[model samples]
Target chain A: MNVLLPQPYLLFLGETTEPGYAKTAFGLRDWSPQRCLGEFSLPGATVSTGLPFLTPVQARNAGARAMVIGVANAGGFIPQTWIGALLEAMQAGLDLVGGMHARLRDIPVLRDAAMQYGRRLIDVREPPAKIPVASGRRRTGRRLLTVGTDCALGKKYTALALARAFQAHGEAATFRATGQTGILIAGGGIPMDAVVADFAAGAAELLTPDADPTHWDVIEGQGSLLHPAYAGVSLALLHGSQPDVFVVCHEPGRDRVLGHPDFAVPDVLDVIDLTIRLGSRTSPHIRCAGVSLNTAKMDTGAALRLFDRESERLGMPVGDPMRGGKAFERLVKACLA
Target chain B: MNVLLPQPYLLFLGETTEPGYAKTAFGLRDWSPQRCLGEFSLPGATVSTGLPFLTPVQARNAGARAMVIGVANAGGFIPQTWIGALLEAMQAGLDLVGGMHARLRDIPVLRDAAMQYGRRLIDVREPPAKIPVASGRRRTGRRLLTVGTDCALGKKYTALALARAFQAHGEAATFRATGQTGILIAGGGIPMDAVVADFAAGAAELLTPDADPTHWDVIEGQGSLLHPAYAGVSLALLHGSQPDVFVVCHEPGRDRVLGHPDFAVPDVLDVIDLTIRLGSRTSPHIRCAGVSLNTAKMDTGAALRLFDRESERLGMPVGDPMRGGKAFERLVKACLA
Candidate 1:
């Protein structure tokens, strides 16, 4: 299913992860958006994650009719300071969309302003539809899951990029989002973390329900097996999706688990093994198909080198999907085959 | 908190696990029951896990004013076959209580029958009270958690038994239940698995709110790290409770993970390590205090031998609480000290 938003789109990328936003916004810009106006961020932000920041007036001038809250925050709360800018965009008659835990429509002033301005308020964190409890029943279609080394480390990015690449190759592929950012981009999948625990897996199952036997359900994973704060969600996704093939996603040059500095990053092989073991609970034949690295922080040459090194070490297809190469696509084709 | 049930109780132990029901009923009978009139099962049911089967009329004759559904079924569904028996007891003017996911009131016939008879339909699976999302806040008190090798291997039994032992030793200890059976016995405590995944831990944190600094909160555990069907709940409980010390509980003779024969039972030390690691996400200094073996199936001599072997190997206290011995109690005292 396609995400419906008014066009052209203005993405709000808070100063946090500029490169991550740029990748997500641009990724969606290519796949879903009719046209991209520009990105927005706090003033004096040095990071260059997504597209360059556009003022609310500039966004209006660019013919942007929808404002997307693109920044992914750890706390998930959209700070009050961002409200004034959002209100301006809403008044500009741009429909508002956000992936934050705090709903945009939940803010009384924002709701009233949106109502007055005749603009839609979309809370992407809220499931677009009701989700059912997963039966853990075996389905006919093949599923590919993007397991990650840590949160915000590009599991969704790899899944989305691979889905696009698979479609480009004329294969039947669907992207299943399991988190807020992915839900915002995918336009229809449930936020697995926000769901009741029992249904977390069920929601994942619902995303790619009743597809052709050969259809590849590319599921977006959340959290990390090695992540201390959020492994329960990750495990639930692993068991729920019951992916036949899983591509391990990681960020190069990170020695610590995300948001946890004291804990050393686990070996990628260990993460792969643990994920497969956990995934095998629901699907006994589950395997690690490849590795997708998030190398947004590195230069293209260095990123490719790291990719090749990991590829040689794990003896699996490994590459940076953001490198604008067919490396990840090739891996996806082999795994689905 | 103690579970207050209307007397006299007639426990419904179906054909599933007679030994299981007998154990659970007898455990509660020892801890909280005013008196267990007798256990009831279908006629011709050979297993004598608990008290002998009593017909509804006979149960009422024996002064059973309440009928407790004693079987722990997967998916928590009370089958239609059992409804007839339950209805009979309900019409006999006995109150009804069950821990199944299917609430008794949802059955129209049962509801009407119950209404006609003025019987109280107590669905123990329902949350007894409102639960909040866990704040992961550091509250004053010491919590001793029961981390099991798998579910229904007697985490609650060990916890309740240990709590009683602590009280007998003149220590300020509270038994915090995290599942239905324990909740039914404890009178109040959140059903951790029934809770939303996000708040599973928070609900656990609320169980022993504002306790004395020196008090020992012996929290009942649910599920296991190795359990394929229910590990997410286990991990959530581990992280939410933020126990100062965790006691690893296991069954000595079990060779495979429950319900998943393809999976071998993980090492007890591994379960302990994983729990400590997961629990430390909220409480960094958390430690595995000891091991509690559910050796109810073994003879006392063999159970004590296995306990000795494990205690020697782990260099920690290990014992069977069901042995009517003080081995586990001494371990708890030493760990808390």
Candidate 2:
């Protein structure tokens, strides 16, 4: 179901040591800064979103309507340690928002507290009750999906940036979020990963339904096609979204697939080629528009040169949305084209 | 959780006119005849399993331990009209078995009746609660999967035949079911389609875990790689099963994907190639051993001739599992090789 999250969030990063786990908080801070009031973290949590650290009461007083549980932990479970903080947030006059696999209402104490406080406990990961199987009918509107060479790349960032760029160019565009972080940022989306396997493609279709001919649904892609564990989700999204143009998201010099030691991250060209080959099952004219290089780990001068070299070599736009400049502008133009 | 079904089931076709909807009954009669006692259906049901029709009382008296809801109607819901017959079956001292998306227990009347009668209600479509994400670790056993050009071909039949053939040749083999019908016949399986999208591959891994190096897991496949709606489940099974050899199951006369008129059934070669390309991420040595031709609609003479021609063209064994002969034997041998 499309979750209508209350506005102005206080991101809750509960006892998470890894910065990677706190990506949800950082994503909101980076992409939807206006929606975020401040950050809240439990004791010993090393990660920070760089936003002002505010307690629930303080953030609520500052007009934060909800406290978003922003740490995407390994198992997507609500840790027992975080229960008190969640209850406290409810007591402090804020609704609770969660994107984890675990439901916020499932926690009895938190559920009771939310009920007592008359607060909403919105779970974004829960899919709608009745998603039909995909029709395989070609949708009318244009779509640009940002696929990835591996997980946790720049796919979401690229889609958000492209959607913004399209709007700046006076084009009708919408960022179709497919994951928890993206959904939280965009305020509503199908958590494609959480949907039943039978309805993965169907959910994608629902997320980006037939829009105006000139409108572009910039869908945020999921797992890599070469990823052994998640290629199914990726393929489902590819066929269902049926993107006319796609951007390959990759991280430079990241040789191995994250969490999968035996597998190597696929080349950007390989990702592009495979996406087109499989995505053509639905969108016959699907083509790679660009490469979204996640240059967050690379030196600026090196990243710039790599983008140029890759663009020339691949004959496509290669740019980092996080490092938007002339290259990103060209990438945006290519997507629109 | 693995289901332990009570043996010798009475196939229940509940007012189904279309033979296609009663495929589960037909499939059971064809593949697991020994486990079936007789057929039962509501009044006005045109479909039959060719077994002697018996009332629940007669079937129960005839040694039927369970009444299997055998009509796989659209939407996988138990029709309201069939509730009286189901309650009657329970009263007649038979446990109810269902593979529909709608849980049998969810029907309050039937749930209460089942509880009062002390009869088990088995819902095979429900997946296990603790399916982990795929580790992508190469498992020990040899696996042979039957892939399809489209849905409802002979994927399950091919896998069942191959598993039997492997056992006949003094090999250690197991038929692994991935769908509701397959699970019912096999008495257990992870309903791959019912699993959360994030854990599809993982559930598959659980379905076919590490085994003896010489053992073979003959995995029943699901949808086609080119199928718009169900390809996610197909890809997940492929990646998770990591089949060393796969048989392409295709219906000879069908041109379009079932229920999706806009999409043509993918070529067997394309299915093979795509399965290999995507499947290689998990099973690096994955390859197609042969083709399983569903030639039920063709005359015997034409079917044989066509098998030989396609075998020659594809440079692999081609046979109809239902029409087992030298061709089917060759296909089985090639799978072992």
Candidate 3:
């Protein structure tokens, strides 16, 4: 579903203390800094975007168009306690933009206040009304998908970085977002997780439609094929994308699937093998380009050595997109090739 | 989602002329005959369930408690012309049961009439309000899933037949439905297709929870793993079911996927291999029990010969459930073992 969010958003961090929960706010601040005015938070929220702190009234005075819900909790619900701040945002002449599983319009008070203040309440997570089943027909365009060994990895960052890299090389490319944070960053995208199971692949197909043969759609993936909770979504995204090439994103030292303790994180080689096995059903020439390693927690020397070892072991480029270097450049080159 | 569908249904074949479109009605008549009272249709509808035809008032007088929308088109929509008959059925004191993409309660006139008459309008395709992501933790009890090489081959029928066979052998078994027709026949099930993409597998986990060690849940599968349009749903069902044993369902001489002319029907062996490869992620001991052949279009002699040939080639029992012969009995024996 495409959304037209008013620019210069005031990020709302509602009672979130963990930096992980405030990833959306951080993501926008990092990627779309020009569009982010400042940050707003509830009383107990300790997380910050490192941007100027602004309340709804201050944000509105400073030309902020909307207050974007910047924290993601489990179940994607809008907590009852957050309602007052949301209403105040609308009262202060700012639109409310949410990417949660729950609809802002579903709350009676919020809906009434938005109408009373003549402010728009945009729910970015809502999918399109109609999405047909995937046709599996090969479309024009070279595409690359960033799959992961587990959820909450750097799939979105890798895709965004790769898309930028392709543009730096003077190529036609677009960053196709699939998840909520990515959707907010890209300004418009289908929330694949919110779509009906039968139409998931179709929604992906719609998200990245036919483009010029040289145009590269660096599609951000969701979940993981090895993830116990969300393999279906991953598979759907994989099939619908039919990427000519794919990159595996992984975080070092993660032994188990996030939140799913019963399942072990799959080997990167197994992920590549399975991706090729299933992805080839749609794109006959689907192949892995390289690995996008998340080395945020690693020391520079150790991360470099691990990258070299992994590259030698897997016979492909391995690099952290966040720490762009020769390795990242090589990975980017492989994606284009 | 479990539903208490008022039994003794007046099957409403709304403006349906082709028998293919009325598979839901035919399924109920054939499988759950005790719950099906009589058939009802619009003025010019030509299809019949080979049961007595009754109008709304006649059906109510004949002790029909519900009017089940029995026709399924491409989009699962209720036609504008058919709304009159649905309203009439409600007015006649019969609860309206529908398994379509369109909710019966969404229609203002029908909703008003249902409230006025104190009747229920049940939309069976709606998923539960909350579903957790799959844990991928193994549950107790045996599971036998019937997967297919293409859509509408006999996955549901094979599952239903196997459930009956297990009971006949003095074993506890339940037919777990995943589609609308199967849900109506079994009286309750999660419509895998209707669930959100991220929760498809999770919903399947909810469908067949832990049971007694000896009990078997015979799950009716959805689309084919090789099906371009629906492989995601098929994979979700496969992973979530984590079947101890699976039966590959295929129709002889079928060359292409239904409704998808661009893709060819996959070989049964490929389906078995892929199922094992993916299903093994969740079900470590997953094995192909046998093959369920749909020989509805083949002559008896030809069907028998094909079954024998396939059994020899696959090194497993192969039989058509509709033909309860020695081959089918052998297949049933293998399932129990």
Error of 2 at B201 (Å): 1.3
Model 1 gets an lDDT of 0.75
Judge candidate 2 at residue A197 and give its lDDT.
Answer: 92
- lDDT (Cα, tens digit) per residue for candidate 3, span B1-337: 4655788899999888788899899999988999988998887889999989899899999999999999988787777898899889988999999988889899998999999999999888887778888888899999999999998889999999999999999999999988888889988888899999888999989999999999999999999877776888888898898999999999999898888788878888999999998899899989998999999999999999999999999999999999989999999999999
Clashes of each: 6, 2, 0
lDDT of 1 by residue, B1-337 (tens): 2334566778777665445444556565667665567777875455453555688788898888888887766667777778888988988878987777789889889889988998988876665355665555678988888988876788998889888887887889988887777876776577766666655556666776767988888999887766665677777777767788888888888988776666678789888777765677678899877888888788878888887889899888888777756577667666676
The docking category that best describes candidate 1 is incorrect
Could you tell me which residue pairs clash in candidate 3? none
Ranking 2 against 3 by TM-score, winner: 3
Q: If you assessed candidate 3 against the hidden native complex, which CAPRI class would it receive? A: medium
Which scores higher on DockQ, 2 or 3? 2
lDDT, candidate 3, at A67: 92
Fraction of true contacts kept, per model?
Answer: 0.23, 0.89, 0.71
Model 3 lDDT tens row, A174-271: 99988888888988888889899999989889988999989999999998887777888889999998899999999999988898777889999999
As a whole number from 0 to 100, the lDDT of residue A156 in candidate 1 is 83
Which 10 consecutive positions of candidate 1 chain B have the poorest summed lDDT? B17-26
